[model samples]
Every structure is written in C-alpha cells, then in structure tokens.
Target: MNWTLEVVVVPVSDVDRAKEFYAGRLGFAVDHDTDLGGAGRIVQLTPPGSGCSIVLGRGVVPEMPPGSLKGLQLVVADLEKARAELVERGAEVSEIQVVGQNPRPVPHPLDNVGFVFFRDPDGNEWAVQQISARG
Candidate 1:
C-alpha cells in the first residue's frame, strides 16, 4: 500500500484573509472553495510544483488556535530567486539566513545552509530552504 500525504489543514483566524495570502500573494493555485452550509467552508490551495496541498477552513481545527502552526518548510531549487519572488508579491520575508545541523550565523560547508522565512496573516510561520545536495 502506498501511503501518500495529500493535504495539510492550516488553522486561520479569517478564512478569506488566509485565502488571499496563500492564493494571491503566494501565487498558490486555488483548487477549490466550497461551502457545505451547515458543515462549514473549505478552501484548498496547492503551491506551484508541489504534490501536497493546504486546506483552510472554518471549524477545521477547532482545538488549535490560529497562528499556532509553525516550521512549515518549503524546498526550493533556488533560494534567492524564490525569496525575491515572495518579496515582489508583498510578503515580508526574512533575509537569507544560514542553517545547518548547528544552525549558525556563518555559512555552512555545503551551500545547503540557506533559508528564508515568512509568516501568513495569522502568523503561521513558513521556511523556504535550498538544499542542492537533495537534488
């Protein structure tokens, strides 16, 4: 049996605002936005070139507070390019920082140590990483 991870539920205070941040600012593809009337509303979006999708909805994760989600990492082939794109789209991303097993300020041995970070409107943090060794 192949166990494939498909969707991740992102808790958001405002569904529409989250939708705008993901879809409009981040350029994620809006797969679906549906209202189940009594059930709730669901908004599914997929990042470009990604297999997994993220879902934002009302009552999706009632126990967890919005902005509690953190350390969601996005792998990119080119870190600088991706960070620039995010900035152009109006995201307040962090400057490129060096990351390694030790997580130091200086450059890592492999160029694989670079990372940039940003957060959604609800403060759900995300990290964009470049690991040439993985490719």
Candidate 2:
C-alpha cells in the first residue's frame, strides 16, 4: 500500500487573514477558498513543489481544540541563507537548534538540518527549516 499525505487542516480564527499570511508572506498558492454549506469556510493553499497542502477554514466537526498545535516545520536548501531570507522577509525567525535526547550525537540535528521557529499574527507557531539535501 502506498499512502500519500495530501493535506493538513490548519485551524484559524479568520480564514482571510490566514490566507493572506500563507499566500502573501509564506508564498503559498491558493488552491481553494469557499464556504462549506452550513459548516463554515474553507481555504486551501499549496506549497511550491510539494504534494501536500494546508487548509485554513471553519466549522470543522469537533473543531480543533485550542492549544494543541505546537508549531509548523519547513525544509529549505541552505540553512543560514534560508534563515536570513526569512528574516529579511520580515519573519521573526529564531535561532537554529538540533533535536535529540541522548548524548550519542548530543543532538540528532534533524538529519543534520537547521531549524528556526516563528509565529503567525495569530500567535500560531511556525517554523522554517533547512536541510543540506533531500532525496
């Protein structure tokens, strides 16, 4: 069985605002944006050169509980350059950090990639990471 991730539902307080942030700042393309009958609104955006998309909408069943989302993860080509680019783009990116618990490598370093965390206007945590390479 070949399972492919298609989309991720990103809950937001306002759809338009989320759309602007994703499309304008993050450079994601708007795929879908509309109403879901009596449910609510739906806005979907796709990242460049990727199969997965992010959906921002409302009226979802069992609407996403607050305080569940920790942050978003992204991958770039050049760690320092990418971080600088985001910072130049007016994004409040944080310093890079490695991930791990044991002392084997001190930190796994996430495939030897660099990662930085930021936040959206709504205080939603997001990240922009960079990897030397990807298969």
Q: In lDDT terms, which candidate is top?
A: 1
| lDDT: worst 10-residue window of model 2 | 100-109
For model 2, residues 1-135, the per-residue Cα lDDT tens digits are: 999989877767777877887788767899878887897888889977768888888786247753245666767666677667677767777887765443334122554445788876666777766554444
All candidates' lDDT scores?
0.87, 0.71
Instruction: Write down the worst ten-residue block by lDDT for model 1.
Output: 102-111
* Candidate 1: tens digits of C-alpha lDDT, residues 1-135: 989878888889999999999999999999999988878899999999999999999854455689999989888878888999999999999999986464444343435677999999999999998864542
Top candidate by TM-score? 1
lDDT of 2 at 45: 92
Task: Give one clash count per candidate, in the order shown.
Answer: 0, 0
Q: Looking at candidate 2, what is the lDDT of residue 108?
A: 28
lDDT of 1: 0.87
Report the error of model 2 at residue 122, Å.
2.5
